[model samples]
Target: MIFTSERLVVKTITEAHKKEFVELLTAEEIITAIPQQRPSEEDINVKFEKAIGFDGDISKNPLNIFGVFEEGEDELIGLVAFLTNDDGDRELGYRFRKPYWGKGYATEITKRMIDYSFSELKLDKITADVWVENVASNKVLSKFLKPTKEFYNEYDNCTDRRYTLLKEDWN
Candidate 1:
């Protein structure tokens, strides 16, 4: 339930991460990139603490969500997660605070998540979806996942494009 990338640490979220976690989840960027949940300090603290209460237990839930922190910093710059869709596929999801944008952190942590999903977790495929106009997200995903489909999202009022990486296709 922990990962040490070249310059980042992917660790299970804990109550200690409340402040930075709230900052990332409630950033305005989320409404554009990921439009489902409206994160609030109180709400997130309660839910995330319970969901990831046991830091080392990856089997607790397939969500596999973790906080991304700089190697020496205690604050979280962003978060990465695996969520299941209506079709039962584990969708790769990530979001960062506005300051962290354009820093390649998203792509870095994503590669880690994808590697864990396929190589360690033995998943057949990993998928990601972005609002049709989210250029940055689309570009990052394109490196490892191929665009496969597009669907309309009534809630977000935009077309959502889907991308996937198969186990055999991962390198």
Candidate 2:
């Protein structure tokens, strides 16, 4: 799916985007935000190839991973993804280059994805899990979902806060 906002374009990740995707995804800033997953350039290209033909499902749901590009330059500044959680809730995740931090781009794209999840996907709820120390992400998620739970991430060795927004509360 393609979603365009005033400052950015959120388009589905495609094979054509392999090179850019690799560079952006492996950037230090993105690695810090998404600690669990970091792939080499070759691995990223392979994943992009695999994602080319994705179709959604409740279980093993294919993600709608979009390249977040600035308005004029076709270059990507980041990425945003929506996937179905184990409980059938739509989960949102995103990361941006450090240079793009503090500019409200994350919140803007996030709000757009939330609208798509509720209105287009007809999702019942949207949730995000963010590291407690990642204050920017916490603030962004708080703009949409109230914090409902907390847990420890053994791998990252950090506390994670889970937030959610119900479809009825979205308007």
Candidate 3:
């Protein structure tokens, strides 16, 4: 799937986009935004390749991650995506290269994802978990979703704040 805003182009990942994904994902500064540490290029390649493969069969792809790009650029500046939880619910997530921080790209991409989730996917709810200390990310989440809960997440080994946006309330 592809989504176009006035200044951004969000689309499903593809094999040709591997190089750019690696660059943004492996940056030391960028890596801090999420739970994962700096990953080897091979690890990124494997994961990105899987996402790209799923992009071809979105109906079967549980992890619906998208590659976000600026309108005039070929580089990957950020990502807007969701992962299926064990309960079969979607958990929203977003991240961007450190250089792109403070440019409002996170907010822009997230708003688009929320719109797509409610309007295109017809989702009843989209949940999110953000590191309790990630003030930057929380600001974006707060703008579009309501804080619902908080807990310690073993996967990230950090306290997480949960947020959710329901389709009926979003519109």
Candidate 4:
């Protein structure tokens, strides 16, 4: 499944995208945002395998991950994902390369994914958890969703702000 916007092409991960995906996932910016403590080559390979094997079966509730690529160069710039909930809701996640930051790519891909989640997946709602210190992510989510709660992730030791957007809230 590929979704095209004005400046990006959000496509399913493939074997051919492994090398670039590894580079992006391990990039310092991404590591800082998502905190992959030891994102070695082997770890990236495992991620690639999981992403490439994703199938849109609601029962299995596979993660729908997409690589964001530039329109002309077609280079992978970031990743956006929707992990299905047991109740048919979807949790959204995204990260962009440092170079692509501040360019609205995250917001663009996010909005597109939200649309796809509701229209295509027939989901009831979409949710996101952003670290309190991640101002950029907080800003993005604020632009598209409304806050629901605040919580702490014991594993990451970070305060997370939870936001949600119901299908009817989309305009």
| Model 2: residues with Cα > 4 Å off, grouped in runs | 40-43, 55-60, 155-157
Task: Give the TM-score (vs. native) of candidate 3.
Answer: 0.88
Worst window of 10 by summed lDDT in candidate 3:
53-62
Clashing pairs in 3: none
lDDT of 4: 0.77
What TM-score against the true fold does each predicted structure earn? Answer: 0.87, 0.84, 0.88, 0.86
Q: Give the Å error, residue 162, model 2.
A: 0.9
> Which model scores highest in lDDT?
1
Total clashing pairs for each candidate: 0, 0, 0, 0
- Which of 2 and 3 is ahead in lDDT? 3
Candidate 4 residue-wise lDDT, 1-171, digit = tens:
467777888777778877678767777767677544547677677778877877655325556667888887666778887775334556888887788999998888888878877887787788988888888888888999999888876656777787899999898
Which RMSD values do the candidates have, in order? 2.2, 2.7, 2.0, 2.4
List, residue by residue over 1-171, the lDDT tens digit for candidate 3: 478776889887667777767867777676676655778768777778776766454435677677888897777777766777655778878788777889988888888888877777778899888888888989999999999888887876788888888888986
> lDDT score, residue 110, model 1?
84
- lDDT digits (tens) for residues 1-171 of candidate 2: 467877988776666676667766677766776555567667776657655655643235556666788887767678887775555667898887777888989899889988888877777888888888888888888998899988887766678888999999999
lDDT for position 63 in model 2:
62
